[model samples]
Target chain A: MSYKDKKVITIGVVRDLTGLSERQIRYYEERKLIFPERTPGGSRKYSFADVELLVEIANKIEDGVQTHEIRKEMLRAQKKQNQEDVRRKMIQGQLNAQFGLRKGPTS
Target chain B: MSYKDKKVITIGVVRDLTGLSERQIRYYEERKLIFPERTPGGSRKYSFADVELLVEIANKIEDGVQTHEIRKEMLRAQKKQNQEDVRRKMIQGQLNAQFGLRKGPTS
Candidate 1:
């Protein structure tokens, strides 16, 4: 999921879900590793992808990867995901053409 | 220069050059905006480009941009730089063909 969805979620909840401490979560925010939304009151809120990223970052740190390396890895991961999406879309288009359906696949 | 080129300078030199504190420099390193190399003794060394990037990062931060946003901006900047390089090469190829120099422009 993208960062736009999942409004009304707070950092405390994210900490609980990701098992990352509040400080580390804030640290990640400060590092720009994750861009969580801040409320009118300045409380941090995380999206689903943000939580996933924090967990991923935690695992990467445990694997001896630094934050900048993790950022690079994430960029690579996002590029791969985009390529996969394009590949899937092409396959779906081919399938639709074979079936003679103007509408796209429901799935 | 890329992150691999410079390999003997220390964080102190970067601090002096950028006017960024040692902790903040280390913090940025931890955040991974710039990747400097380390010596065999584990000292951080800044490349010319790395130093430029640190100065850029300082400007971005002062302008109230977060690290993740800055990261995205940097990716865009790199992509733009790559496009400019490609455009330059294409022009150079055209010039070489017009000059009957398959070896390319002397300058």
Candidate 2:
């Protein structure tokens, strides 16, 4: 599907995808955990990314991690992953250099 | 240091490691988010795993995931990761089979 036309899932859809109850999802919204866009009729619409994030949040909770703590951990993990991605790109660049496709010593 | 004697950290230590206030950590415990071991003197003793979990929980909260929701999301993420790891192992096994290092015909 085109990016803009990609389905904007309803709250029920998000609940099903994340295996969370409607009440729980609403409660999370109230806590500013997720801010799904609202339709003109005031219906919540979630994106696929939102559903994935909800799943991640659910996993942390099942591990007995606290909500606030989970927030911090998610941010840290995201940052760490970003850094790792950059490092991987650097390594790939080095590999390319070995084939004389790029010019640079390993960083 | 040996595992057992590696040091059972105090609540203060946990707070420092998790960047959470003592009250917040205690609140999480009351909510059954985390259950650190207790000392004979009724002091809370956190393990390294507890610290790591706390860090993860903190990340979720910062990401705007709710407490109860975070619990569910964390659980789901953990299951997903476990499943992914198993899938990766299976793929690895298939690769090994291609080299006659395993006894399977690509299941």
Off by over 4 Å in 2: A1-7, A78-107, B1-107
The C-alpha local distance difference test score for the whole of candidate 2 amounts to: 0.70
Report lDDT (Cα) of residue A98, candidate 2.
Answer: 82
For residue B53, what is the lDDT in candidate 2?
A: 76
lDDT of 1 by residue, B42-64 (tens): 66756546667888898989999
User: By TM-score, who's the top model here?
Assistant: 1
Docking class of 1: incorrect
For candidate 2, lDDT tens digit of each residue in B21-96? Answer: 9998897777667777665557776655676777888888899887898778767988999999999999988887
Worst 10 residues of 1 chain A by lDDT: A1-10
What are the per-model DockQ values?
A: 0.01, 0.01
How does residue A55 of candidate 2 score in lDDT?
Answer: 79
Instruction: Give Cα distance to truth, residue A43, candidate 2, Å.
Output: 1.3
Candidate lDDT scores, in order, read 0.73, 0.70
Give the poorly placed runs of model 1, Cα more than 4 Å off: A1-107, B1-8, B102-107
